[model samples]
Structures are given as structure tokens and as C-alpha cells.
Target: MHWESRHERAPAVTVLAVGAYTVDFYIFGDRLPSVGETVAATGTASAHGGKAANVAVAAARLGGRARFIGAVGGDQEGAEALATLTRDGVDVSACPRTDPPTARSFICLDSRGQQYIMTWAGAADGLTADVAAAGAALLRPGAVLVLQGEIPVAVSAAAAAAAVPGVTVVLNPSPVEPFTQPRSDPDAARLLARADLVVLNAAECRRLIGERAGSTPSGLSAEAAQLRRQIRTATVVVTVGAQGALVIREGSEMHVPAPEVKVVDTTGAGDGFVGALAAGIAAGMPLAEAVLLACRAAAVSVTRQFCIPSYPRASELSHAPLSPRQC
Candidate 1:
């Protein structure tokens, strides 16, 4: 999204994100060591993560007014997560603290930008549909309500159903587990039907819809088209990472290439892309242009060593030239 200075009183593009918040401990450098082997690491640091929190931080960094709604524990990690979100200019007033310990993710990054993550749900597992409904009410009309798979399915569905008329509900079904069953829960299907856009990886698209995805050269595109046919209201965006991104809407398709950059960490690349895309859409940019902007932002994100830490500010993205190489 093209961001005017906040001081100029431009209407803020509010984003209400529903998901989890976790303490992320990152060990970056080469491949993870074997069971009995210990390898040297280039660096180590910690940050606030979780699909929702990372996306909210990404949006805020890209000049959107982002708010995060979810459950956290009353422990030190929870306090730190809240502080991190507030520091990033994300509204977290509606984020509650539960009795369980806060969630945590330990990430190990390889030199090629690939990452392996292990997460603990903690209090996030307890988030309910009621909490999502309450959170949805706080979203401003025309705002964007973004959801991911980290929270309870019922909660995500409720948030999607409660979106304001002019608001866009964006769903990202990542890590691709819960919806793998042959038959989806009626409530989940209803929620998917309400999404303005559904963003996922190539594998996720396959899980949602069967192998009947078309015969296109790009399996991702074929699957995206199949998914769009199933849920008529939602546009499908399947990210193929280094292969760029594919967008399918109303039977039309577009491919946006990913910018080239040296790999470092890809932990939050998808979140970065989706967050920027949502910000662009909320700012009234056309879908194609928004996807392009999201690609650029994601390319920038992977060049750095961490997830949220790698996201650039809006001004940085606005002033930067696009990279030449296509991923």
C-alpha cells in the first residue's frame, strides 16, 4: 500500500488480526546439528512471534494500523509479547492473559533461508469463538480482518463471520494440518466461504481441494483454481515461495514473481507477504498491484536473519527499487 505520512491525517487502514503470540528463540546460521552433534551458530536472538503477531507487526511496519487479539499467559513471556507488540505500534488492548503459560516457538534457520520450527500452544489453545466475536466488533468498517491457523478453528470461523460489511476478511491456512480431513466441519466451511481472500502455500491448496486441480504447468495455480471453484466468494492466492506467487479470482489468474535476494531466514516470509498484501488491499490498491507489493516486501524479509525483525518500514519499501532477478 502507498502510505502517506501518518501526520498528514490519512485515514488509517485498520487491521484486526486474530491468532497466537509466542516467544521465538532463533538460532541462525547453518543446518541444524544431528542428535549427538553440536554445530556452531552464526547468531542467536529472541522476538515475539506467532502467525497473528508477526503479521500484525509486519502490517504496522508497512504503515497500517494493526491490532492483535488473542490469548496469552500471565507469565514473563506473555508480558514480553505484549510489550513487543506495543513497541511495534500494534494495538493489543484486547489481548487477554490466561492462566496457562504463553506459547513459545524455537526456530532453527539454515544458511539457505529454510527454517524448522517447534511450537507450544500454551494459552493459545484455549482461545474460543466468543473471544473472536468480541475482537471482531472492535474492527473499524473497511478495515481488514486477518486470520491464521494458529488459533482454534471455531474462533477463526467466528471472526470471519463477524467481519464488518466493508471490511475484508483474509484467511491464511498455513502449516496445513487441521483442514486435511476429507470432510470439513460445517462451521469451518462456512467461514471459508466468507473470506474475501484465502492465502496459502501450494501444499495447503492440495489439502483443501483434491487432486482434481487442473493440468496447468504450475501445480499451485491448478490447485488455487480448484479451491476458488469450491468457495465462490474467496479469491485464492497460493504462494510458491521461490517460484513467485499465483492469484486466482473469478476464473482469472495472475502470476507475480518473487524478487531475488541472498537467503538468510524465511521464517516469516509468508506472513510478511500476506500482511503487506492485506495492507495494500485495505488502502484500496487493486489486487494485482497489492500482490506485487507483497512480493517485494517478502523478498526484503528473507534477506534478513529473523522474521519480524526483517520487515522493513513503509518508507523503506516505497523508496526502494524492485530487484531484477525473479525467484
Candidate 2:
């Protein structure tokens, strides 16, 4: 089904995104240069991008009320980041600029549409529990708190905890790493328990499972099941690029297929998926239906270039040529 953004002037739900903010430099070249090799970039562009920023912009473009709670550097990039969010109709009052330079990502894309990104956390690493708590206050019963792994784990945990009982907490653990928090840390426990849904890609799922297992395991299906069991309180959705995603919830599991699309630059596809998914769920769409809409949005994202620019507006999705893939 082709779902369009039907949000009214007064949106029924709000999306509060807590994570990183960065200025992205996209360098397109014929190929990746080897050590000591100099290959001139064929093209280049700069944009405001970071997982949280991208998600916020995407949510807003899809007609959701998006509020961002993150940190930016005290430099020009920070100013630009805030301006971009404002232009996208996202609320940025909760985001603060810090002493350090704003985060930056140098994305290298080749002719084949593959991307390699090097990101500097910079001010994004400065997110603290106090800052997160202030943002959490905005959460209401039906609000959505979207968290990503780009910021300090403690901050993500705090934001999750701030969600009231009826609020839906969605955690996207991209750039996932081993749990450094001691097993006894109650904050970590709360982080896992509070998430109503956890969205992650296949590699993140494997790495998280590996961290818990003390070693890397084999088989995607088995590992996915293990991840679901480990994060027992939340429904797990593992995305496999092109093939789509695996959704595990309430003692059942199934696959959702994504429409095939030619890739250009995959900078913000996952963020687009997560953001649209949050918007759909906040609009009261069922989990499975939301995933389908998210997958469609993501497929549209990879066919374009850059980050926020690649995200499809609600009207664009309505007119997209690709038919919905069978769920």
C-alpha cells in the first residue's frame, strides 16, 4: 500500500530525536585512492547530516513534528546544522552548541554508489545525562522518543528512561559497539527495558550479539533470534540491505521485502527508514505496516545522492513508480 503523509496542521504525535549532529562532506570519485595515491574527486557537496539530524529532517519532511535534542560544535558547521534543521521544520531548541568544533563526516562515494564515511564525534560526544533529561521532559504519553548510538550510551539510556509509560521508545543502534557498561549498571538495564522497539541493521545485530556472546557467532537467523531473546523487553527489527528486514516480536518472526532500486549513495537510507518508521508508528500504524512504509522510503533514499536531500517527502512516495513489495 502506498501511504501518504496525512498529518493535520496540528500533528497528533511528536517525535523527539536524541543523538548526533554533523556537517557532511560528500566526495565523489572514480574509485578509492590507495595509500599515498591522489585521485581527484569527480564531484563534491556538503550537507547537514548526522543520524539524528537526518532522522529529524526526514520525520519533518514526512509531516511529523520533530524535535531534536543533541549537541553541535561552536563553529560554523554547528550554526549551519541548526539552520538546516530549522529550515526543515524541526524544533531545535533542545539542541545546544558546545565549546568543541561541531562533528564532521567525510563521505567518499565511488562510481558504484558505495560509500565510506569517516566521522569525528566532536561536540556530539558531549551529550550528558542532564541535557538528555531536559529533552525527555517533552515526552508525553503518545510521543515517540527516537534514540541512536552516535551519542554517549548513558545519554541514550537516560532518554529512554525519560519516556513515560505510554510513550514509545525506538532505539536504532547503528554504529553499535560492545557494551562497556558493567553488567550491574541499572542504567544500562533501563535502556534495554524501556525501548518498545529496537531497529538495527544486520551488522549491528551481529556485533551486538557478538559482544554479548564474547565471540562472533555464525548464521544470521540464529543470531537474530539470540538478539531478540537478549533484549527481551523490546521488539527487534533487523534490516538486511536490499533484501529488506526481519521483524521479531511477541514470540513470532517474519521477513519484509524491500523494493529493488538502483543505488546511488546510501548515506541516509537507514536513517530515513528509522525516521519514517517512527513517524508511521506515531501515526498509529501497526508495526508491520510501518515497516513496509519504512522499507519503501529507504528504497527511495538509496536511489538518490546526499543525506537529507535523498529522503522522500510524503507526496514523492505517493507518486513513486515502484510498486509496494509483497510483505
Instruction: Please report the TM-score between candidate 1 and the true structure.
Output: 0.87
Error of 2 at 314 (Å): 0.5
Summarize candidate 1's per-residue lDDT along 164-225 as a digit string, tens digits.
67667888977666655525577667777788888987767877776633445456676788
List the pairs of residues colliding in candidate 1: none
lDDT of each: 0.78, 0.78
Clashes of 1: 0
lDDT of 2: 0.78
Deviation in angstroms for 154 in model 1?
0.3
